[model samples]
Target: MTVSIWQSNLPPLREVDFLIVGAGLVGCTAAYFAAQAGRQVVITDALDVALGASSRNAGFMISSVDVYYHHAIAKYGHDVTREIWHLAKRSQALWYEFINRAGGTVKFQRTGSLLLAESEAEAEDLAQAADAMLADDLNIIHHKTDPLKRGYFAAIEQPDDGAVQPFELVHAIRQQSGVSVIPNNELYHITQHDDKFVTAYTRMFIFKARQVLLCTNAYSPRLHPYFINKVVPTRAQCLVTEPLVAPVLNTCGYSDYGYMYYRMTFDNRLLIGGGRKQNIALENDTTEDRVTDPVQQVLDNYLKRHFPDVTVPVSRRWAGIMGFTPDSLPLVGVLPDMPDVGFAVGFTGHGLSLGAGTAERAVNMMLHGTHPGALDAKRLEPAV
Candidate 1:
């Protein structure tokens, strides 16, 4: 059964030209774009805006994949990897445009991102990664000394990376005209109608639309059974420390290929998350607010090891679920059997950086039957 919780005290559902399930970053932005096209659109979610991974995320706008481009090239070929990199760059630009147009203070910070290497071998790998990215024209530089002055690991800084308040951006986009967002409304079933899609929710209301898009991420399996096996849920634990007198991290930092990431909020607070692989089983669920002791312990040790002098008290601690596919790339395209239905999910925790571009490409595919070079249809195709 689905649940319906409206953000604003609004009336019941109504027919529209497009119905988007999961009003996260991707869905809400897609709604705004579609609505601006003079299409009547209704966006629904099981929770309030940004309540899912979109809101719970650390808000880092990365311009690379989970793995480095060299690694991706090795696994998926250079042509495919180059296309992905280009998509990320375009997505980063779109994020800036949205933030500027919304006039929302999403704390857009373009301080760049640093990937640290804890060992010599890791440092060598980082160098290779930087070289590959440079060859592809990405603005990534490999540095030996720690830029944050926190002697943790050798780093590679990507100057194009930035961060934003995910929830604020989502809300701002929702405020646009022609886009109606219904929160706490869960979509259970989607059926095809004549030139339209029928979406059934547990609220006993059926929504009619010319098209439907699924952007549910980790919890997507519930709405589409095929995604259950294709997309796996992974939990990421995050905690924010009270505003420090002198922020230790001026730029976002990631180590171990994003298993551990920490960044300084605009308010001078340290926001850190990851360490899911430590408690893989416990982190393999869809629940949004479960913080395990082991996960927290790893975070604590990381803090102590990295910032030995900083004595910042933890302000907030929470957990968010991110979707993972067999490969790390996201699935963004039309489903095989469902022509009127399209989707963008399984971001593997990289959605914060890549979601906007993915959404734009997905929307383009739905409207014009073509996607940007960044999105690989084969990678996004439903598993056979």
Candidate 2:
């Protein structure tokens, strides 16, 4: 006796000034701002709240860019890298402001995080990166000491890093958006109609909007060819251990330039996720959510190597899909030729902290006709 979403209670011909896809942090935040700016808005999701990337993440408001400072500098050059990092910190600030407006009860805390270098060469690179960040007036410390080094050569602490309950963050943002949320209603296909986008998701969705924002992240390419093969849908697996008395990790962090990362929950449980590179072939796909044994084995070994004394049982194991760009930036712009539609996808796993501010900028780009500054519009354009 289950009713299809098409048969669910919905208007046959609903209209909105703005229709946003995806209900994750980015989408929700975008909807919040768009509605605040007086746009009749509605948000749709493929699944229930907190079931997608927004829920299945390490729950961190990590301060730095997904591509570390040194790695990003190597690719995008020093000045551009510095700009990206500064924008990343700005994104974190917007997120904090949003959370505070909602009474700051999202388990949000400014717990500084560390990036551990595995070798002396890597340690040197970390120190140089730290120096560059300091020159940019960003707070960071490079420690050569092994006190908090869990089998690493050295670590750099980013004092502005923080953690939050991903579910709570989205939930809090939804409260303010006032946008109609329609979950379990996936946007299968969308078409341009009379200068408005007509979306089909369970019987035409009865939705028409002057503009549509594709915040679908890993699922972006599936809806529009503009992002095909550019915004790569990557898989990341994670596991949470049973609550322990006291965990060594009190903050959110990553290692080896974000190939692996771990963070502690407020209840003193360690949640470690990553290692997609271990099975590069298997992890590079568009839509696969099943947890593989090989990746799980790698995570188990990571825990044993780092937290030897913690014999706590694993509470659960799961996987989430994230997007990565050919270059380490998200697609944040209106369609090159089609100006009526816009998007802000491909966060590369840093969207947890960067999504809110990124969405705000994207909203401005759409409504106010201003170009996005935090992200590069030229580099993120559809692959020609």
Candidate 3:
């Protein structure tokens, strides 16, 4: 994404109050919050709005990390896990508010979500997660047997989680935020000139801004060296079948330990994603947004094995890059050398669940110096 000398000298430098990089979900959400704070906000993106993973995701708004609840508590502690879950809940609430303001343009449903188990072992894990969630007084129902009768062994249903039209959702947020956007403009370099201003070099314009917040997610590493090892780009593949006569899945169904997920689109198309579990070497650490044969083949097998009723041809197939963090939590912090350049990236494939809330926290920290709690990047620093 480097800007060459030939492409760099088109426009004169401009000054902005607040500059946001990446116009996807997180970036737009950040713009929304920044504008609410009365800062003139501008968003710039390489591709246009919601063209990346934000719109390309399966659109499940599950209020948890990429892993099961108990596993999250095991990996990060109980308090941290609870706080992350609440963050996701807050994101969903914000999304609902935006959808309400969309005036029927955005399609969404509160159909809830089911975390299904593919095997006995996974079923046992679901039970454990259910116990942990119940102990925390979280509203979840555990079904000892598969409710979908789709060959799953067990399930955990989160009534609060739901499905969304991701592309429309982002556009709605952008429109509601009332922020001017410079589309198809990619940021190549950014630096803090002084405490009062940060300079950014982009494909279209050089911007000197009072503050900058990067919601670039997967592309953050390419924009700056600070995100190098902290935010690793990973690819996720998905496909959708031609419309079916009747609805097959009534709710968002997640399986294979949250790797594979499927749901019925608003138009009755069956959309399914996640085969990277078997093709990790091919899919990991790559930003290429193109689907490969191996991963798509696994998805095809999964569809046929569990959803034999779905015989329609695939309408479309696509891939999107996600930012994966080492600890499986989104990071909120400023660049070590550039203190005013704040960032909220590394959603680890759970952007829809965590983006809005993390964006709010990131905006507050950058403008009001509020601590981001569990999502603070200082948590990742090595202890002496």
Question: Backbone clashes in each candidate structure, one number apiece?
Answer: 2, 0, 0
Alpha-carbon local distance difference test for all models: 0.77, 0.79, 0.92
The candidate with the higher lDDT, 1 or 2, is 2
Residue 77 of model 1 has an lDDT of 90
Sorted on TM-score, best first, the list reads 3, 2, 1
Candidate 1's C-alpha runs over 4 A off are 1-13, 193-199, 202-204, 371-384
Which residue pairs show collisions in model 1? 5-183, 5-184
List where candidate 3 sits over 4 angstroms from the true fold. 1-10
lDDT of 2 at 241: 94
Write the residue-wise lDDT of candidate 1 on 94-203 in tens digits.
Answer: 78888888765666888788898866777788888988877877777878765666664578888878878888877776775357777777777666645455544434
Best by TM-score: 3
Candidate RMSDs in order: 3.8, 3.6, 1.6
* TM-scores of all predicted structures: 0.91, 0.92, 0.97
Error of 3 at 141 (Å): 0.6
